[model samples]
Target: MQPVHIILLIVAYFSVLLFISYLTGKSANNKTFFKANNSSPWYLVAFGMIGASLSGVTFISVPGWVESQSMSYMQMVLGYIVGYAVIGLVLLPLYYRLNLTSIYTYLQDRFGNYSYKTGASFFLLSRTIGAAFRLFLVANVLQLLLFDAYGIPFWVTVSITILLIWLYTFKGGIKTIVWTDTLQTLFMLIAVGVCIYTISTEMQITNIFSYVAESELSKTFFFDDVKTGDYFWKRFLAGAFVAIVMTGLDQDMMQKNLTCKNLKDAQKNMFWFTIVLVIVNFFFLALGVLLTDYAQKNGIDAHKDQLFPIIATKGSLGLATAIFFLLGLIAAAYSSADSALTSLTTSFSIDILEIDKKKNPEEQEKTRKKIHILFSFVLIATILVFKYFIADQSVIAKIFTFAGYTYGPLLGLYAFGLFTKLQVKDKAVPFICIIAPVLTFLTNYSTIQYFNFDFEFFVLVINGVYSFLGLFLFKK
Candidate 1:
């Protein structure tokens, strides 16, 4: 409830993570950091990926999203099931068979150096922005609820946040993250469960499920409006592609899956991760339903991104609820971020710098530590930019829209690589990737201006199609 208490909660929480890092950090090298020496347990990786996948966006934004979007996010969550299948059965096998540290290396093998560098560069840009976006949202909440009361500047809060991630992850990398993510996921789920149960009890609802089911905000499908953001098919199909690109094709996500001891283990991890992710997301949207109802009945005027935090801290939810809320938010935010930093380092080292091709292991490790610090600052700067320039939209929606541009080329390149045997003009890929997102934006703008229809959730799908066509045209 108090700023001091929140600070103490964060301190105690990271203390546990730092202790885990100490244990896991021993004998750590680039291999342990990159692939966890291919020793991570499938079950641990599966459980940890839940926290990494959701991040602070879902923790705060999803619950708040219920007021405007209702339960329509479930369509995208359902689509994730389809996407994860592609990851498990298709992408995982390919990555494992190739023994890849960075999944983008597959592009070099399939295409050439130019296409490979293009894919890797796109991933670096996408994940840097994505990770920054995730941290920015959580840091804003911290500034609002805790830091502002102490007259702390927002930049200070963000710097400290990024610094903590680097401290623990700098040594053990994914090996430490596999363990820390498990703890974070546990705290995250516990927070959600606590809030759901406490809020339902406060509202005096006898059947939580029945209450959620009966609420108008609980409406999940939107088949009638084919043009709106909430349209079922549009969201479902988009959700599948989002998962495929953001997870399967992503270095930050696939890096963890690659840590598993074998292909079967990684596949099993993806399967279970999907099942739990779907169920966990439902609880988030359900929490959103309860928060919105609670806010309305109490005459609190919050909506969108502010709904969950306002209610949890200011809406008389008690000290226990507040404590867990901060923990959950921090857990969710850092779980993904720590891995993002590591994967960025991994991708850059392997894909961009070709550190692996060199003979000196010690030199490679030194280079990685410097890159780790470099990205830590990069995240800090990006968050500062978001604070100044980002609009008042729900943060999750912002992430997906941004991904439509950043990850879309990745989807097209991978699809072109895997499905078609056509040899690509590798030199044109960097240029084609740039044009795909630009074409996507123009098409989306034209549709809205001329026909009053927007791409909404279909942004990635449209961009990917554009990218595929672009690649097809330039094929050798």
Candidate 2:
């Protein structure tokens, strides 16, 4: 495909998103932006979340991950099922009961003003970096495949990418995202399904069962090595906690759940979302096996995160496959990125700035608009930083590792709040949250150096434990 054709496709895609935004953003106010007026359908929110949860990182990186980890990522996927169940049963009811616009507000009700600010600050730091990283992946890909051909700069590519998201989401916020994400998720899944069918046909394997049975790379269980990162127990436990922190505790994710009409509907959304997420993830792993097998048989040099793009775009999979790959990549990338932008706007406006309390409704909306645009620029700057510093590691691994440090504090804070009645010296909460990650980092370094033990995602668990203990010691 020519660069012009690809550009045209992208233009058409954004046109649809803008139209959806126009419809959803009509008469949108603070309520619509923050909570979607608590009017979204349960099923729509559930279906749309599939794309947000997977994002571009999974769409591009998961298949590539198969080359190194095989189907072991499935261990985490299985763990997510249990984690989602916990969220629906435990966290959702609490949030609904409180009628919270921001989940971190729970920290305030449980502890004090300092704890509330601490939790929201952690989310801002974590989601800012995390969302930037996710957008960076897709922006880098766009620069490589399209902009470089047109002699455009990487910064320009990123600016355009972030601008498109802001265009759709700046008005309706979560309300627009509820509908836009559903559309993007559909595109993403269609792209994956088409790519899988194309590859299967090329390999002359009509039966997916036969293909899976024959491939060595399809191995899913990994109980043999307790010391390695892919150990089933480690991956499973880490996966469960990851879901709890990243989804249950995350504002970007939980915001969508909050948009549902009520607790019962939200729980229903979580139930169905978990089942579909598991099935979708299984297909991604299956696609990874196929990609790795194809690469090996054809002597493609690419491995890790490079495998999917290399095969889909440059391989002999044909033009249709390439087209779908582009669509899927954009859909998956923006699906999450759009929501991240909104959630960051929500957290900063409501939590950090206390915009709701500090301003009249008109002024709050004005302040939120500015913050939304500010974070969009922040995302662009962060992506540029990643371009300079991020080396050849898998983007997905980098994301998870970063989450281990950033989100671990959140996990600890929430755990302490929910599981215990002891109240900490409110002023000390921020220091504890900051110290937890730094201590977790030092512990991770020492253990790796002396014990030769890799904590991987379990580092999150350690960070949470340290934070929990810190709070316990500081109890008033």
Candidate 3:
């Protein structure tokens, strides 16, 4: 496809999103933006969340990850099922009982003002960097495939990308995202389905079972190596905690769940979302096998993160496959990005600014609008900064590693709050949270250097344990 055609495809896609925003943003207020007035359909939210949960990182990186890790990522996917169940059974009821606009507010009610700010600040730091990384992947791809053809700088491309997200989500917020995300999820799934079918036809695999039987990359279990990243128990446990911290504890994710009408609806959403997410992830791994096979047979020299894009855009995947890839990539990227932007806006406005206590309704809305735009620029800056420092590693792996450090404090804080009734010296909460990640990092480094034991996602567990201990020691 020509660069102009790709540009047109993106323009048409955003037009549809803007229309959804216009419809949803009508008469939207702080309630609608933050909570969607508790009116989102449970099923729509569930379906939409698959895309938001996967994001562009998964859409692009997970398939490529299969080359190195094979189907071992499924270990984490299975763990997510357990994590989501815990969220529905434990966390959802608490949030609903509290009638929370921001899930982090639970920290305040359970601990104190300092703990509340600490939790929300961690979320802001974690999601800001995480979301920026995801968007950076998509923006970098666009820069490579389209903008470089026109000599556009990376920062310009990133700014344009963030600006478009702000335009659609600036008014309706979560209200718009519930609907837009559903549409984007549909496109993402269709793109994956079509790519799978097209590749199967190209490979001349008449039987699906036969294809799996022939491929070595389809192997899923990895119990043999306790020291490696692919250990089944290690991956499974890490996956469970990751889902707990990244989705259940995350404001970016739980904001959609909060939009559902009640706890029952939110729980229903989590159940079905978990099921679909597992199935979709399985297909992504399958696609990875196909892409890697296609690359080897065709003598395409690409590995890790470069595998999928190299074949889709540069190799002989055909024009239709290219179009679907572009569509799927954008759909997946924006579905997550749009919601992250809204949730960041929601968190900062309510948690950090205390817009409710500090301002009248009219002023609260005004302040929210300003914060929403501010975060868009924040996202752009973070993405540009990432461009300077990020090295050639699996983006998905980097995201998870980064999460282990950033979200571990959150996991510990929440676990301590829910499982124990002890109140910490509230003023010390922020210090404990800050110290936890640094200590976790130093422990990881020392263990890797001396013990030759590389902790994968389990680093999150370590971080959480450290934070929990810190909180316990500081208890009043």
Candidate 4:
């Protein structure tokens, strides 16, 4: 596709999105923006969540990972099933019974003001940085495929994308997000479906199942010893814990789950969402196997992450191939990016600064708009900074590795609050949270450097232990 064509296609896509935004905003107000008046259909929230949870990173990076990483993610993802169940059974009821607009409010009721602020602040710090990183990954892909063709600067690319999200969300907030996310999810499904069909045809692979089963990359369920990282027990535990903490405890994710009308509906959504997620992830991993097999047979160089895009544009598949892949890529990126911005706005307005209670509707509206702009700029700037410092693929991966450390405190704080009745010293919570992750990193680094203990993805376990220890020792 030419630069002008891509620009036109994008413009048309955004125009349609803006129209939907306008429609969704018609009934929106302060309450509606914050929680959608608690009227959203449970199924919509469940369906829309697939897009938000999967994101552009999963869409683009996951398939690539399969060819290299022993298909171990499926094991971990199965663990997420148990994690979401815990969230649904335990966490969802608590949030619903309390009638929370912000989940962090639980801290104030249980611990103290300082605890509330500490938990909320940890969310803000981790979420702000994490949101920026997710957007940065999406922006990098957009820059490569779309912006670079026009000689547009990276910041401009980020600005335009963020501005589109802000414009749609400033008024409607969560109300608008539900409908927009559903639409994005639909687009994502269609794009993936189309791409899959196209690849199957181009490769002339009559039996995809046999291809996957016989392929060298088909190590789906790991039942090996726990001593290995990708072993069944480790991946399963990691998957479940990662999901509970990363998705269940994450404001960015739970914000959407909380929009359901009731706890039962939310639970239903969670169960259904899990089933769908398992199947969808399986499909994507299968696609990865196919991509690997096709590339090997054809003597392609096979860059792990870039394999899908390269296969999508191979000459035999023609112009529609590029169009479908671009559309899929856009859908994947925008589905997550738009929701991330909305959650940031939601969390900031309700949690961090408490902009929701300033007692002036007009001023609250004004504050919402200003913060949206502030975060929009922040997302853009982070993308530009990422581009400058970390162009190498390995470095980009490491940046994500570093960002993964932030979620440990989230896991610890929630675990401590829910499982224990001990009254934690509120003022010390934030310090403990911060110190825990830093110490975890130091321990991991030292172990790797001196002891040569090749700690796998179990860094999550290490971080969780560190946070747990910090809370125990620093308890008042």
| Residue-level lDDT tens digits of model 4 in 44-156 | 99888898877776777777787667577788788889999899999999999999888888888987887777777776666666666667766766677778987998888
Model 3, clash count? 0
TM-score of each: 0.99, 0.99, 0.99, 0.94
Q: Could you tell me the TM-score of candidate 1? A: 0.99
lDDT for residue 429 in candidate 2, whole number 0-100: 88
lDDT of each: 0.93, 0.93, 0.93, 0.76
What is the per-residue lDDT of model 3 for residues 405-460, given as tens digits with 9 covering 90 to 100? 99999999999999998889999989999899999999989988898777888899
Clashing pairs in 3: none
Q: How many steric clashes between backbone atoms does each model show?
A: 0, 0, 0, 1
Model 4 vs. true fold: TM: 0.94
* Candidate 2 overall lDDT versus native: 0.93
lDDT of 1: 0.93
Off by over 4 Å in 2: none
Model 4: CA > 4 A from native: 222-228, 391-400
RMSD of 3: 0.9
lDDT digits (tens) for residues 148-245 of candidate 2: 99899999999999999999999999999999999999999999999999999999888986787678878888988787888899899999999998
Q: What is candidate 3's local distance difference test score?
A: 0.93
